[model samples]
Each structure stands twice: as C-alpha cells, then as structure tokens.
Target: MSEPILSLEAVETDIAQYHILKGVSLSVPRGQVTMLLGRNGVGKTTTMRTIMGLLRNKAGQIRFDGAEISGELASSRCRAGIGFVPEDMGIFSALTVEENMILAAVSGAPDRARLDWLFTVFPPLKTFWKAPAGTLSGGQKQMLSIARAMIEDRKLYLIDEPTKGLAPAIVSTMVGALRELKRQGASILMVEQNFAVARALGDHCVVMDDGRATWSGAMADLATDHALQERLMGLSMEAG
Candidate 1:
C-alpha cells in the first residue's frame, strides 16, 4: 500500500461542553477512497469535520500529506488542496449554478476545460447553468455540491453522505461520477450510510463508534464478512 496522504492520531474534539471525538485515529492511503462508516450520531460527520479543520481538535494531531495541520485554519486547509462537500451540500442557495461553480475556484473562475468536463459529467449543471441553486431538485443540488468540490483538482476530498436521501437512479449517477474520480486516483474520505455505495466505492474502511475509530481495514474484508458488518454497521450487504 502507498503511504497515507492524511492521518489522524489520538485526535479529540469537544463541542462547547460535550466531548465528541475521542482519540480517533485513521489513515487515508494516497490515491484511494477511504470510507467513514457508522450509524447516525456516532460522530462520523464530526470526524470528517475535524479532518477538514472545521472543528478544531482539542487534543492529538491531524496530519495531511505527512505534515501536521492541527492548528491550520479551514481556509488554509482548503488552499492546501482539501476540498469539502459537507453533509448539507453546502451550496449557496441564492446563487446561480454558474456563480456557485465560479466561487468554488480559488482564482474566482473555474478552468474552462474543467468546467466543460464537469458539465458533461453532470449534464444538469449545464442545463440549469443560470438557475438559482435553490430552485434545483435534491439530486441536482447534490451534483452541484460535488461539482463545487471537484471544480478544481483536490488532493483529498472530504465528502459526507453523497448518497443520502436520493432516488436510486440519482444515486447511481452520483456513484458513476465518484467512480470516475477514483479512476483519476483522487484520495477521498467519505461518510456514507449506504453500505452498497460504500462497498462499491471504498478501497479502505474506517468504522467509527462514539467518537472513536473502532476499526480500520480493507472494504472488501468488511463487505464479505456479514458477522463483522452486523457488529460494526448493523447490516450485511444483502440487507444493506
């Protein structure tokens, strides 16, 4: 296996008075997808936020590309090539699709070639290019959100639930786009509740429970072991 592009060791985070992530540790191998899996309210999203530098770690270290980034601001992290597609699909509702894409680029304008390719990858983005983001359907919003993070080439992408609450057809489209990214050798840390999606996309898996990383290994191993799946994620591939 290649060296990890990102690693969190003994990391902890607290939300005001409540301790959230406690001693979480995991690794994302370079150019591979690492799935962050857990039931809801298990601090899965919190762990993603912490890695993206949104929630400051109260203790331990967060290292990106072998460098410690624990004290860096979120913007600095973004500038360092970490793209985040938050769980809420953090697009500005009032902005047009064009505007959202433009804003995602650090230079204030997306590269023309990449923009064209993105439009192909997500045709609806081109169809509704001038439409306000708020007017888009849920699936379109998700496409826009993913496109924004992908507007520029990123070293590592922190994605939270790309398949959540979407129709199966839409989910498949999302899956196809993500698979393309994987082919391009993008390193991704994604939080997914959909086991099928996770199994399909994840190269490595990190199972979290109660703000702690409880397991880390190959996705294939977890996928084939129904007993392990039930113990960690509470479902086997057949049921998931």
Candidate 2:
C-alpha cells in the first residue's frame, strides 16, 4: 500500500475534565475515502476536530502530507489544503447561498469551471443561488456545506456525519455526490453513521469504540462480515 496522506499517531484529546479521544490512531490514504465509524459518544467527531485543530490533542502527533501538523492552527491547516465540514453543516444562516460559496473560495470568487461542476453535482445549489442559507432544507444545507468545501482544491476533507437525519432520497443524492467526489480523486476522512453510504464511498474503514479504533480494514471486508460488524459496531448489516 502507498503511504497515507494523513496520519494520527496515538492522538489523545480532552474536553475540560472529560477525556474524549484516547490514543486514537488512523490513516487516510491518498485519493481515497476512509470511513470513520462508531456509535454515538464514541469520539469519532472528536477525532475529526483534533485533525482540524478545532480541538487540540493532549498527546501524540498529527502528520499531513509527511509533515507534523500537531501544533498547526486550524486556519494554517486549512490553508495547507485541508477542508472541513463540521457536523452542524456550518453554513452562514443569514448569508445567501451565493455569498456562502463566495466566502469559501480562496480567491474571493469561485472558479467558474469548478462552480459549474459543483452545480452539476448538487443541482439545488444552482436553483437556490440567491436564497438565504437558513431557508434551505436540511439536505440542501448539507449539500451547501459540502459544496463550500469543494470550492477550492484541497488535499483532504474531514467531514462529520453528513447523512444524519436525511430522507432516503436525499441520502441517495448525497451518496451520488460523494461517489463523484471519489472519482474526482478527493481524499476524504468522513464520520458517517449511515452504513450504506459508508459502504458505497469508503475505500478503507476504521471502527471506533470507547475513544479508540477497534478495527481497521478495507470497506469491502467490513461490508461482507456481518459477524465482525456486530462485534465492532454492536449491530449487524441487516440491522444497520
């Protein structure tokens, strides 16, 4: 296997008095989607935040593109080619969709070619170009969040629980957009609760429990192993 583009080695993080991530370690290979899976309260989001520098790690090292970024500020990391889509979608409620996308662009305006492609990927973004982001439906907000991250070229994307609470049809649209992202060679480390979406987009998998990785392998392996899924995730594929 090739070297990972992003790596976390024994990363430890705490929130106030609570220890959320304990010795978390994982790798995101170049040009592939690596799914981070876990039940609620299992530190999956914490791990993503640590990578983004939203939460500082109390211990261990974070390496991106072969350099240590453990102490880098979130802005610095973002400038160095890391994009983040937080769990809450992070769109400016008061801003128009066009304004949000414009702000996300590094050059103060989105590149026409890329913006056109993004519109193709999520058509509603084009339809609601002038609408306030707060007025968009939940699924549309999620699409806007992802579209914002794609406004610029990035080495990796750290997305948290993108499919949460979406209707099945909307989830399917999200799955299609993500699949297109993969084809376009975007490296992603995503925390997703929806197994079907995970299985569709994940090239590799990391299963977390109680703030640590309990299993790691190809998504294909995890997808077929109902027994292993039950052991690591506390539910079978059928139940998922």
Candidate 3:
C-alpha cells in the first residue's frame, strides 16, 4: 500500500557460521499488523532481531519510512522509531511496575494520553502499578512489557510471541490490546505461533519456512484456505 513503513528486500542473516535467514523478504505496511507465522526454529525471531539491528543482515536492504536502515546500529534503529518487545518480555525484575514504565520515558513526558490508552487496553497493568515486576504473574508481566514499549513515541513495533505462556483469557486480552494499537495507527510486526490470536489481530500474514518466506497474503484468505494452512502452518481450527 501506501509506501510500506518498513521494507525488507532479500534480507539474509547469519548466527556465527550458520545462515538462519536465507533471503527472506517482506514488507510491513503502515498501520497494519503483519503476522509472521511459522513453526518453532523457523527464523521468525531472527527476522525481528535483524530488523532491530540486534543481528546484522548479510545481504539485501532494510528501509524505514522510506530511508535505508540496513546498516544502522541497534541504538540508531531505536532512535529511528523501531520499538521491540522480545519473547522474554524484558521487564526489569526488581523494578516496580511504575518504575519499569518510567524507565522507558523519553524526552516527552511518556505521553499521558498513551499511558491512559494502554491502561484502558490492559487493566491488569493498572492494578499492578505499585507492585514489583518479579511479583506479577506471567500475564501481568507481559502487559507491563507492552506498556513500557508504548511509553516511547515509536511508529513501528516488533513483538515476538506475545501470547506464548498466558491463560486463554489473558491471550484474548492481549489480542484486543494489539487490535487497539492498530486502530491508533501503529504499524506492528508480530511473530506468533498461536494461530487464533494471529488471525484476530493480523490484517496481512506471511508464513516463513526454512528461513525464507514461503507464503504471503491477506489474513482472511489464509483463514479459509485449509490446504494452505496445513501445508504452511501445519494447522487448522478443526484439528486444534
């Protein structure tokens, strides 16, 4: 669409001597959640790491808001509005929920309206504001991680396995929060193994296999294509 906010053209990444992402190409359209799905160990996390400059791309290009960002350092990428929430959720264990949120505060005063918006989306975080992050449950910790990311004024967010270890109810809450992020015009690239959660939050979808993109289309199309689902994701609603 409207000039993708982020574009990865033939991106290749390696960990030591191993080539993990072999010529993967994808684009994150502005204001949409582009779900990157694949079985475990399929280079999904590597893709996110490469985008954030945590890992360098051996080949191809990465462009952010129309400018090439492939060669930038991790901090440079962060400064360029690329926010990331790793699978570990990266919350400081000793810090209180409010302290964790404050650590992400930038030049601006952490956008009071955005913090309020996050509170509306994740009520559990609001309740745990004064508690230590280490004391919160897995789901609550995840909410704090997401809230910290939103405290920064970033245009793009790269989130990995956001619903991994939560209860079904909390998973639904996470889905709703991500949907609201899209409504607020934030572009998201999410790597998810939970198909139902992906379908609920994604507008576009890409399935990666063997370190490369094997399928890409609108999420609605993928939903109805049972054959494609089995072949690519090895999943379907009936089987689950």
RMSD of 3: 1.5
> After superposition, which runs of candidate 2 have C-alpha atoms over 4 Å from their true positions?
none
Q: For model 3, what is the C-alpha lDDT against the true structure?
A: 0.88
* Number of the candidate with higher TM-score, 1 or 3: 1
Error of 3 at 78 (Å): 1.6
Q: What TM-score do all the candidates reach, one by one?
A: 0.98, 0.98, 0.95
What clash count goes with each model?
A: 0, 0, 0
lDDT of 3 by residue, 1-240 (tens): 399999899999999999999999998889888999888899999999999999999999999999999889988887778888999999999999988888777555677787888889999778988989999999999988887877776889999999998999998888888887888888999998887887788899989999998989898888778888998977784553
Candidate 1 has which clashing residue pairs, if any?
none
Worst 10 residues of 3 by lDDT: 231-240
After superposition on all C-alphas, the RMSD of every candidate to the true structure, in Å, is: 1.0, 1.0, 1.5
Per-residue CA lDDT of candidate 1, range 3-99, in tens? 7999999999998999999899999999999999888898989888988888999999999987899999999999999999999999999999999
- 1 or 2, greater by lDDT: 1
Q: Model 3: how far is 207 from its true place, Å? A: 0.8
lDDT of 2 at 146: 92
What would the TM-score be for candidate 1 when compared with the true structure? 0.98
Instruction: Give the least accurate 10-residue stretch of model 2, judged by summed lDDT.
Output: 231-240
